[model samples]
Target: MSADARERGRIVVGVDGSESSKDALRWAVRQAELTDSTVDAVTAWEYPPLYGSIGWIDAPQELAGDIKGAASRALNHAVKEAVPPDQTARVHCGLAYGTPAAVLLDQARGADLLVVGSHGHGGFAGALLGSVGQHCTQHAPCPVVVVRG
Candidate 1:
């Protein structure tokens, strides 16, 4: 890490290509600006479970790659939409293959703050807090901020 990076704080936010996630990204960016911190926007994906007549089956490698690619695209899109062009330099985007909560927690390991949407693409639509958000708030290594969209 560069000396400048070490001196500036880091904020990790989870993005799931959902409206709420976008709101969370926006909130994180504003917070980063105020605190002079850099935002790490992260998205995670996993191969969908396939069911066969015999039992569970592995997803094809090509299909898995496609899913991963989609996740990357979503992360990029979310960052582009949420961050202002002038503030782009303050944001870093990343994608990982894992559960959303786990990936976010990992990214926030040494961060000053962990941010997430109250409700993401998954979970009950009427829920005030999505499963991933709840998990992150409860388990993140750093202080967590749950933004409601």
Candidate 2:
């Protein structure tokens, strides 16, 4: 891990290429500006196993690579849309290969705050706090801020 990986006082935000996540990203960036903390926007992705794989026809690595690329692009787009041009330098993006809650918790290891949208693009879209947000709020190592859509 690099020095940046171990940096403290960072504000970690979970984004999933959703409108609510964009709102959370903007809120996190604003909070970071006020607290003089760096914004670390993170997106997580996983390629589930194929339901019925034919013999020697599965390309898990390629599929996983594509998913990772999409996750990276999504994270970059979210940060670009949420962060102002002047403050972009202070914001960093990360793509994790795991569940959103796990990724956010990992990012929150040495962070000051963990921010997430009230309801992301999860199956329970009508809930106040989606599974990822609820999980992070209850399990994050740091304080969690849930931004409503």
Best by lDDT: 1
RMSD of 2: 3.4
What's the lDDT for candidate 2? 0.84
Clashes of 1: 0
Q: lDDT per residue, candidate 1, 87-123, as tens digits?
A: 9999998988889999999999999999999988778
Every model's TM-score: 0.96, 0.87
Question: How accurate locally is residue 28 in candidate 1, as Cα lDDT from 0 to 100?
Answer: 94
Against the correct fold, how does model 1 do in TM-score?
0.96
lDDT of 2 by residue, 82-149 (tens): 88999898788888888888888998997899999988776674566788888888999998999986
- Those runs of model 1 whose alpha carbons end farther than 4 Å from true positions after fitting are none
